[model samples]
Target: MPTLKELAKRPERLTPGHRLCAGCGAPIAVRLILAAADKPVVAANATGCLEVSTTIFPYTAWNIPWIHSAFENAAATIAGVESMYRAKRRRGEIDEEIYFVAFGGDGGTYDIGLQALSGALERGHRFLYVCYNNEAYMNTGIQRSSATPLGAWTTTSPVGRVLPGKTQWRKNLTEIVAAHGIPYVAQSVASNWRDLVNKAEKAFHTDGPSFINVLASCNRGWRHEPSETLKVMQLAVECCIWPLYEVENGVYRLTYKPKEKKPVEEWLRVQGRFRHLLAPENRHLVEAFQRYVDEEWEKLLKRCGEA
Candidate 1:
C-alpha cells in the first residue's frame, strides 16, 4: 500500500473552475474516487451540489464521461445505463468493459433516492454508488436530511426553546445497504485521504453493487472557517462520531480506530451548527450523544471481532 502522500499524487479527474464552495467536500471526494478508479468510467450524478456546481451550462468539471440525472433517480439511471451496456455486450455491439459510478448527496440517497438505491442493490448491479453525505440538503439551503446527526442545527431543525437542532439520530444508510447482502459496503471520510482512496479502489473492483458513504463537511452550512474542513472531519472520526469501516461479503471490519475516543464536544464546538449545544446544561446532552456513539461503536466492534 502506498503512503497517503504518494496516493494523493494521482491526477485528479475532477478539475478546476468548478463552482463548489471553498472547503466543499463533494468535489474533493470526487477527486479521490476518480483517482482510484484509474480507468475510464461513466458516472451518473444526481441533482445536488455536485451536479449544479460541476455543470453550469456549457462548462463542466468532470474529466470522465458523466451525466446529470434527476435528484431521486441517479441510482436507477445508472442501473439503466449499466443494463444498456450489458445488452450491447451480449450482441457484440461493444466489447469493452466500463465501470459505472453513481454519485448523490445525503438528501438524494437517504431520503428521496432510497427506493431507487434499494432496487439497484437488490438487483445486484455491477456498479459503485457513492453518497457524499454532508448530513443535510446543503446545496439548496441548510435543511435537514435523514443522514443529519442528532442535535445538529439546520434550517429545518433550528435550535429553539423546545427543540435542540435535529431531534432524531442519523439514519444508518450504510447498514441499510449492507442488509441487501452486497459484496462490499464501506464508510470513509475525506479527512482521511488514504482510506478514502483505498475504499474507492476496493469498491471499483468489486463485482456487485458496492456502496460508500463518505463524510463531506460543508463549510458554509456548518459555519466554519473554510480552512477547518479537514480538521472538522478529523475531529468527527476521533470523537467516534464517524467510524471508518468496510464490510466485504457481509463481514464487517474496522479500517481505522481512534487511539482514544475523544470527546464529542471537541467535534461539535468547531461548527456553528453545534455552538448552541455548548451551553453549560446542554453540554450534558452532547455527552449523552457521545454515549450513544460509544454504544454504536461497541456494536461495530463485535462485528469487527474486537469484542
Candidate 2:
C-alpha cells in the first residue's frame, strides 16, 4: 500500500488553475476523491461549485469521462449512467471495471436534490455520492442552505436585531444516508487527506451505493482569511464542532479524536458568521451548543464502545 505522501503524489485528476476562490475547499475535496477513485471512472456533477468552475461549456478540467447535469439531478443522472454501464457490461458492450460517481454540493444533496439521492440509494445504484458541503449555496452567492449550521450568518440569514444568522441546526446527512442502509456512509474533512481518501477507497470497494459528506471550507463565503482555511477546519474537528467519523454497515466510529477537546469558542471565534455569539446571551447559547456536541459525541462514543 502507498503511504499518505505517495497517495498525494498520484496523478492530478483535477488539474490546477480552475475558477475556485482562493482557499476554496471544494477542489481540495475533489482532489482527494478523484485520487481515491479507480481508473475508468465516469463522474456526473451537479450544477454547483465543482460543475460551474471546472466546466465552462467550452473548457473542462476533468481528464476522465465526465458530465455536468442540472443542479437537482446529479444522483438520478449518475444512477442512469451506472444502470447503462451495467446493462452494457451484461451484453459485453463495455468492460466491467469502470466505476460511476456523482458530485454535488450540500444544497444539491440535502435540499433541492434529496429525493433523487434517496431514489438512487433505494435502488442500490453502484456509485458514490459525494457532498462537498461548504455549508451554503456558495456558487449562488453564499445564500443560506439547509446544511448551514445553527447561528451562522449567510447573506440570506444575516445577523440582525431579530435574527442571529441561520437559526436551525445543520441537517444530519450522515444519519440520513446511514438510514438508507447503503453499506457505507462517512464524513471527513478536506484537511484530513488520508481519512478522506481512505473513506473514498472503502466506498468504491463497496458493492452498493456510498455517501461521503466532506466538510469543505468556504473562505470567502465564511468571511475568513484564505490562509486560515485549513486551520479553521482543523479547529472545528478538534473543538468538537464537527466531529470526523464513519458509519459503515450500521456501525459508527469517530475517526479524529482530540487529545484534550478544546472549547467551541475556539472554532466559532475564527468565522465572521458566528460574530453575533460574542454577546452574553448568544455566548450562553454557544456554550449550550458545546453541550450539544458533547452529548452527540458521547452517544457516538457509546456506539463505538468508547463511552
Candidate 3:
C-alpha cells in the first residue's frame, strides 16, 4: 500500500480541463479512486456527469485508459473488459498488473443500471463498481431517482400542494450491493478523501467484485453554492444521513463513529432541496426524515456490532 504522501504525489489520472460543474463531486471521487489504485487502471464510466463532462468530442480529460459505457450497462461493460483481461492473462498476451473500475451516478446505479450491477456482482468479476450518488438524475435534469432522499424537492417530485418533495425514501444501494455477498462493500462520502481513498484501495486489491456508494453532492441538484460541496458532504456524515462504513466478506464494520450525532436538520439546512421542510407545515416532514435517519443509523450500528 502506498502512503498518503506517496499517493498525493502520484500523477493525476483525471486532468483538470474537463467542464464539470464547479462543485460537482463526481470528478473528486474519480480522482481519489484513481489515485488510490497502486496499479494502472482501466476505467468504464456510465453516460452521466463524469463522461459527458470529461469527454467532449475529440478532447478528453482522462489520462488513463477509459471507456464511456451506456447509461445502464457500465457494470456489464466493465465485466466484459475484465473478462478479456483474464483470458489474455491466461494466454500470456498481457503481462501487466492492471486494475478495473466502473463509475455510475445514483440515477444509473439505483434504478436503470441496477440489474447490470447486480449481475456483475453476482458473477464475481474482479472489478470495482463505484456509484457517485448525487441523489437524482442530475445530469439530465434535477429529476427524481431512487437514491433521492425523502421529502427532497426534485423536478419530478416537486413540492406541490398535492404532496411533499418525494414521498419515497432513498434507496439503500450499499446494503443492496452487500446482499450480493461480494468481497468488499463500502459507503463513502466525497468530503472524506482519506476514508474514500482507503476504500478504493481495498476495492482495487480485493480478489473479487467490490462496490462503493459515495454521497456525491451536486451543486445544481442540491441547490448549494459551489464552495459548499465538501461542507455538504460533511454535514451528511455528521447527521448520520450517510454513514461511513464497510462490509468485508459479509462482516459489517463502521469506519467512522461520530462522537455526537448531529440532527439531520443540520444537513438539510444547507441545501435548498430541503428548504420546504423548514416551513411550519412541513416540520413534521423534517421530523420524519430525522426518524428515518435515526432508524437507519441504528440498524447500521447493530450490523457493525456497536448496538
Candidate 4:
C-alpha cells in the first residue's frame, strides 16, 4: 500500500478542469480509489452530480476508460464489463491486468441500485463498488435518500412545524454491504485520503466482491463553507458520527479511532442542515441525536471487539 506522500506523486486518474463544484468531495473520492490501483483501471460512474459535472457532453475529466451508467446500475454495468474481460482473457483475446471500480451516489447505491449491487456481489463479481455518499439526492434538488442522516433538512424531508427533519437515522450502508458477506467492505471519507486509498487497495485485491462507503460531502447541499469541507469531515470522524472501519471476510476492524472523541454537537454545529436542531424548541432532537450516535458508536466498537 502506498502512503499519502507516495500516492500524492502518482498520476491522478481523475484530472482537474471539470465542472464539479468547488470543494465537492466526490471527485476527490473518485481520484483516491482510481489512484489506489496497482494496474490500469476501468471505471463506471452512475448518473449523478459526479458524472454530469465531470462529463459535460463536449468535455471530460476522466483520463482513463470510463463509462457513464444509469442512476441504478453502475454495479451491474461494471459486473458485465468484468465478466466480459474474463471471457476475453479465457479466449486469449486480451491479456492485460485491469482493475474494475463503480462509482455511485447515495441515492443510487443505498436505494435504487442496491438490488443490482447485491446481485453482483452474490454472483461473486471481482469489482469494487464505491458509493460516494453525499447523504442525499444532491444532484436532484437535494431530495432525501435512505442514507441521509436524521434531523438533517432536505427538500423531501424539510424541517417544518410538524416535523424535525429526516424522521429516521442514516442507513448503515457499510454494515448493509457487509451483510452480503463479500471479501471486503469498508466505511471511509475523502478527507482521509490515506485511509480511503488503503481500503480501495484491499477492495481491488479481493478476489470476490468489495464495497466502500465514502463520505463525499456537498457544500451546497449541506450548507457549509467551501473551505470548511475537509474540516467538517474530520469533525465527523472525531465526533464518532462517522467512524473509520473495515470488515474483511466477516472480521470487523476499526481503521481510525480518535484519541479523544469529541461531542457530536461539534459536528452538527458546522452544518446548516442541522441548524434547526440547535434551537431551544428542538433541544431534544440534539439530545436524541447524541444518544443515537453514542449508541451506534458503542455498537461499532463492539463489532470491532474494542468494547
Candidate 5:
C-alpha cells in the first residue's frame, strides 16, 4: 500500500470543483481508486451522481481519459474500450500500458446494469468495475434500489404505518459478482482509506475482471450531517453491517474486523433513513435487522475460514 504522503505526490485524476454534495462519499472513493493506479487510466462512468456532478456539459472534473455512459452499461462501455486497447497494442499501434476503470452508483450497478456487468465479467475483460453504493438511487431523487438496505427510508420505500421502509433486504452484489468467478472482488468503505486504496491497487493489478462494492454514504439521502459521513461509515463497519473483505482466486479474506463487534443499533441510530427502526413500536424491526447482519457476518466468516 502506498503511504499517504506518496499518494499525495501523485497527480490528481479527478480534480476538484464539481457538483457532488458536501458529504457525498462517491468522489472520495473515486479519488482514492484513481490515485492507486500506477499506470494511466481510462474511466467509463455510468450516468449517476458521479457522472452528472463531475462532468456537467463543457466542464469536467476528470483529468484523465473519461467517458460518460448511460444509466446502465458502464461495464460494457469499458469492456469495448479495453478490447480496442488490446487490439491496438497487439498491432503495435500503442506501446504504453493503460488501466481501465468503470464507476457506477448502486442504481446503475445493482439494478439497471447488472446484465452488462455480468456479461463483461463473463467475457474476462481486464478492467476494474467499482460500485459506489450509497444504498439507493441517490442521483435520481433517493429512490430505492436493489442495493438499499432493509428498513431504510427512500422516496420509493417510505416509512409508513403499513410498511417500515424497504420490505426486502438488499441484493448481495459483491457475492453475485464473485459467483462469476472473477479474479478479484471486494467490499470497502471510503472512511477506511488504507483498505480501500490497497484493494484498488490489487484490483488494478488483477489479470481479469475485478469488482469492488464501496459503501459510500449519502448525507442528503441518508439524512446525516455532511461532516458525519466518515463517522457513519465507520459505525457501519464496526457494527458488521458492512464488513470489509476481499475475494481473490476463490479465496475469501476478511480485510478488517472490529476489535469488539458493536451492535447494529450503533450504525442505525446515526442515519435518519434508519431512524424509524429505532422507534419503540418498531423495536422488532431493529432486532430483525440485527439478526440479518449477524447472519451475514457469520456466513462471511465461514467463507473466509475464520468461523
Candidate 6:
C-alpha cells in the first residue's frame, strides 16, 4: 500500500466539481480505488447517484475512459469492453495494459444488477466490480434495497403503525460473490482509507474477476449531518456491522477487526434510518439487531479461521 504522501502524488482519476451530495462517500471510495491502480483504467458506471451526479449532459468528472451504462448492466458492459480489449491486444492493435472497473449502487448491485453481475463473475471477466452500498436506492429515492439492514427506515420500508423499518436483514452480497469462486472479493468501508486502498490494490492486481462491496454513507438518505458521514461509517465498522475483510481464492481473511467490538446501538443511534430502534418500547429491536450482527461477525471470523 502506498503511503499518504505517495497516494497524494498520484493524479486524480475522479476529479472534483461534480454535484455529489455533501460528504457523500461514493466519490471518496472511487478516488481511493482508482488511485491504487498502477496502470491505465477504463470504468463503466451503472445508472445511479455516481453516474448522474458526475456526468450531467455537457460535463463529466472522470479523467479516464468512462462509460455510462444502464442500471443493471454495468458488469456486463465492462465485461464486453474487457473482452474487446483482450481481442485488440491479441491482434497487436493495443500494447498497453489497462484495468477495467464497474461502479454501481446497492440498488443496481444487490437487486437490479445481480443477474448481470453474477453472469460476469461466472464467465471469469478480468475486471473489478465495485458496489458503493448506501443501503438504499438513494439516487431515485430513499427506497429500501436488498442491501438495506433490518429496522432501517426507508420510503419503501417505513416505520409506522403497521410495523417497524425493513423487516429483513441485508443480503450478504460479499459472501455471495465470493461463493462464485472468484479470485478476489472484499467488504470495505470508505472511512478506513488505508484498508480500503489495500483491498482495492489487491482487487486490481488479481488476474480474474474481483468484487469489492464498500459501505458508502448517504448523508441525505441517512438523515445525518454531512460532516458525520465518516463518523457514522467508522462506528459501523467498530460495532462489527461492516467488517473490513477480503476473500482471496476461496480463503477468507479479516483485514481490520475491532479489538473490542462495540454494541450496534453506537452505530445506529446517529442515523435517522435506525432511530426508531432506540425508542424505549423498541429496545428489543436493538437487541435483535445486535444478535444479528454478532452472529454474522462470528460466521465471518470462523470463515477467516480467527474463531
lDDT: the better of candidates 2 and 3 = 3
C-alpha lDDT of residue 277 in model 3: 89
- Which ten contiguous residues of candidate 1 have the minimum total lDDT? 1-10
For TM-score, candidate 3 versus 5, the one ahead is: 5
lDDT (CA) for every model shown? 0.91, 0.87, 0.93, 0.92, 0.95, 0.94
Alpha carbon deviation, residue 196, candidate 6 (Å): 0.7
Segments in model 1 whose C-alpha atoms lie over 4 Å from true places: 1-11
Task: Single out the weakest 10-residue window by summed lDDT for candidate 2.
Answer: 1-10
lDDT of 6 by residue, 1-307 (tens): 8998999999999998999998999999999999999889999999999999999989999999999869999999999999999999999999999999999999999999999999999999999999999999999889999999989999999999878999999999998898899999999999999998999999999999999999999998898999999999999999999999999898889999899899999888899888988889889889999999999999999999999
Clashing pairs in 2: none
Residue pairs of candidate 3 with colliding backbone atoms: none
Lowest-sum lDDT 10-residue window in model 3: 1-10
Provide the TM-score for each candidate, comma-separated: 0.97, 0.96, 0.98, 0.98, 0.99, 0.99
Better of 2 and 4 by TM-score: 4
Task: For residues 170-205, write the lDDT of model 5, one tens digit per residue.
Answer: 989999999999999999999999999999999999
* Candidates, ranked, lDDT: 5, 6, 3, 4, 1, 2
Expressed as tens digits, the lDDT of each residue in 1-307 for candidate 1 is 4466766787667889999999998888888888787657899999999999988988988787898769999999999999999999999999987899999999999999999999999999999999999999998899999998888899999999999899889988999899999999999998888899899999999988999999999998888999999999889999888999999998998999899989888888899999888998687688788889989989999999978
Candidate 5 or 2, higher lDDT: 5
Across 27-126, the per-residue lDDT of candidate 2 in tens digits comes to: 9888888888766678999989888888876778888889876999999999999999899989999875977889999999999999999999999999
